[model samples]
Target: MTLETEFRTRAFEDVRRALLERREIALLDVREEDPHARSHPLFAANLPLSKLELEVPLRLPRRSVPIVVLDDGEGLAQRAALRFTELGYTDVALLAGGVRGWAAAGGELFQDVNAPSKAFGELVESERHTPALDAQEVQALLASDANMVVFDARRFDEYQTMNIPGSISVPGAELVLRAQQLAPDPTTHIIVNCAGRTRSIIGTQSLINAGVPNPVTALRNGTIGWTLAGLELAHGSTRRFSPATDGAVRVAAAAAARAVADRAEVGRTTRDEARRWADEAVRTIYRFDVRTPHEYESSHVPGFRSAPGGQLVQETDMFAPVRGARVILADSDGVRANMTASWLAQMNVEVYVIDGLTPADFTEEGVAPPARNAVTPPASDEISPAELSALLQSPGTVVLDFTASANYVKQHIPGAWWTLRAQLADALPKLPPAQRYVVTCWTSALARFAAPELAELTGKPVQVLTGGTSAWLAAGLPLETGETQLASPRIDRYRRPYEGTDNAREAMNAYLEWEYGLVAQLSRDGTHGFHVI
Candidate 1:
């Protein structure tokens, strides 16, 4: 069929005008989900190439609606324009320079639908807009009788593991929905924090975006900054839940998480109880403070490692490989620890949450807890961290850090490579099975879950960082910190040259387009979940 709609090669001016004039222009991103989740134009509605026929009809309810198409540095836009034209879209046009041009024009790009880049940008911009306090500053403010309501804008898991003393988990995405859950008085001064900067910025601004009638500010650089400033971090020894809420519910949830761990009967661990497991050299019990990366990076349990909540759920086997070995969880917040514990229980694995215990508390209380279940199985076939490390010293040991790109860029353990969590399951097959694989993160929680799974999936001796990166630093091991982000086709295209092999450029472009739209495609995976941190 001949193309009916003429292509507008110089449509930048038109797009700028349409945006300013409030004219409805469907700025369609033809890029796939992964890259789109990584970053995208602020106002763009993603219309991926594969889903063009399906999404176009749903998004563009009006037949004659103006739409623009984009692909990552490819000529797919022209093909898409022809397709749209063939599909009866008269006003369809290709965006000049596509998303690249929008970015070049200094338009804000969003990361995920709950955009962290926008939130981080607004937060950087907000330093001048709001009155922020660091952990020390907040302490001083409290000492000076400043009435501030502290909200932890991390996942409930991180909050329960260790938060800024009094902070509560009111995550950024839930800020708009759960604002009223806090603040009986709207006039109270509000301060928010996550492990580091991103979520706090977004969470604090979410309040402002929703026009909440409270003076909100983020803890400067969040809890990492809080710890670097020589502040005290709190952990609960026993979870404090609402008296009205049944403890059995938590037990039921813990049972679920144990199931994830592949255990039949689950048991609880007290501070002393957990220490007994920690003391056993043969056992190799990995303690994960299932909190956000920022929080885990800042300060966590001395022996405990960071394992983000959602990722822990998805990749439980990787982190805790003693298939049915004991895995203990600690969170500063009750809800997240309980929630993750529940998932672990469902996995049929042994799990427990550390409640109200600081490092001092652990030292004060010896290892012991009231007896419960005695179904401790035989020694797991799981390889220890020391074994994995020995393997790494050999040739081809691929260490993947499945954490946020920004966090991965900031500081990671020495010799670890960056891999996005969304792409972790997909990236596994690419590595040669002969190579030893070590999947790690800032802390043990993610590694605790991911490492074992990697071992299981790749059948390579996969080991988690026993105490995560913090342990590495404490042991005086070197760390790699820099602005140098891991090179990917999506991040650094110049590094990957196009050899004229079977349309390499076209294939790469198509792959990136698909990557940009990956999360949306994952929704089609029927997983009934989204990435939580």
Candidate 2:
């Protein structure tokens, strides 16, 4: 068959059947974040076409995994499928009728990012009826000397942003690994919390699953509930769980985690077995070192990409788009990988924890560059940071910042208009006419991709900032802040109602109610291959 005939459109019903059968398939939304968040299928992963090469190889692994690319009639799916073909992806198809097509075929469309995992978390909570304490009870406990400790099961940076007054930073996977150090006294009362309910529920359930001897409970609705109760939150708190120093405690924790993993039917595999799996041409295997970023960058087994265990569990759909692909998790400490694998297994993933790992086995050093099918070198029209600074003062020059709107709000070169790479076609008409254009992003990696497009769109000379906005900061150059001067709409991220302190009370409650109904939604949708362990 000709290439045109081979690139067929997959029906939404057929895709649903694959999901129900627990077969390997990747449903990708080839659009920017904002547009994708507006509508998509339950299992569709947003893999923006602009960053396809930069992210796809690690995410999709085996080239032969069946992939259905979808778009909202922007003609992006056809272009993305062709790009996938160029990247040597053997089986690529387009979703017929795009987002509208799915709806036309009676497929349920979900709003927001990470919808599948969020829905799964809701399902887990509903089935298990995970024990939890409401805000009032938690407040009363805090008022008294109840011997209770609240652990924030979110990233440290998020904890730093805002948290319950006395909660300590102990992110999800670390809860099991650091339990011995944080709460050696079995009688101590433990409360797990997150920005919302999901991580906290998972963290509390993780402890319960491991058979920890403590009385544990999730803080109902997490910090959102706390905020709704007229309680104050502490900002810039640095309290964190220290590493386990006692060998006895570490050994005990590891043993507990292993037994829990065993109960969940998570397999164990040796290095030789892992290597053999990686070499298989037909099966997709995702090798991930599920440890802290610092630990993975310092040392890890080669060929394993860094994916912190907690985030990996919460963002599995993002990391491994193929539903039934084999996932191999490695970490020197037995607690992290095992605990993480148990959750994946319960989520109907084929997961395994590396067996018999040691410090000596971590031979690789530093972060691995993302796997890319193509890389265009810095072309003739690149300018140094100093050169960009000089050019910014000239009348004919206009700088377009192609980074995320959040980053642009945080810090960006003065006079650089916040721009979106994917929206450049629409944005060009909005931007002021100029004789020269300089494009930039975080590392100029994305900026290089934008440079050629911007040049072609405007038919103007476009120079890329040698190393993007980061290099400008390093040079001690002057910068500005806030959401000013946008050439493109800031549709890169959907702001969550639970985030930040300024959300309206009604919005927060609405978000909670939405989460509460996810289990019912899951039942109606009927494609999630999830079960309680």
Which candidate number has the best lDDT?
Answer: 2
In TM-score terms, candidate 1 sits at 0.36
For all candidates in order, the CA lDDT equals 0.54, 0.86
Best by TM-score: 2
Q: Give the alpha carbon lDDT tens digit for every residue of 377-465 in model 1.
A: 12223434555556666778766765545566678765676654323455655544456666656665445545554565676676566
Task: Please report how far candidate 1 places residue 170 from its true position, in Å.
Answer: 3.2
Instruction: Give the TM-score of each candidate.
Output: 0.36, 0.95
Which residue segments of model 1 deviate by more than 4 Å? 1-10, 33-42, 45-63, 79-90, 99-128, 138-149, 153-166, 171-189, 194-216, 223-533
Candidate 2 lDDT by residue in tens digits, 1-533 = 32354478899989999888878899999898878987899889999887776678778878889999999998788878987887788889999999999999988888777888788888888888899998889999999979889999888998999999889999898898887678879999999999888898999999998888999999999989998998888999999987545788778888999998999899999887898898875778898998888888899998798888888888888888888789999988798899999999988899998898778889999997656434444464899999988877778899999888999999999989888777788888877779999988888888887888788888999998888999999999999999888987777777777665365688789888878888887888888878888
Candidate 2: residue pairs that collide: none
Candidate 2 lDDT (Cα, whole model)?
Answer: 0.86
C-alpha lDDT (0 to 100) for residue 238 of candidate 1 = 27
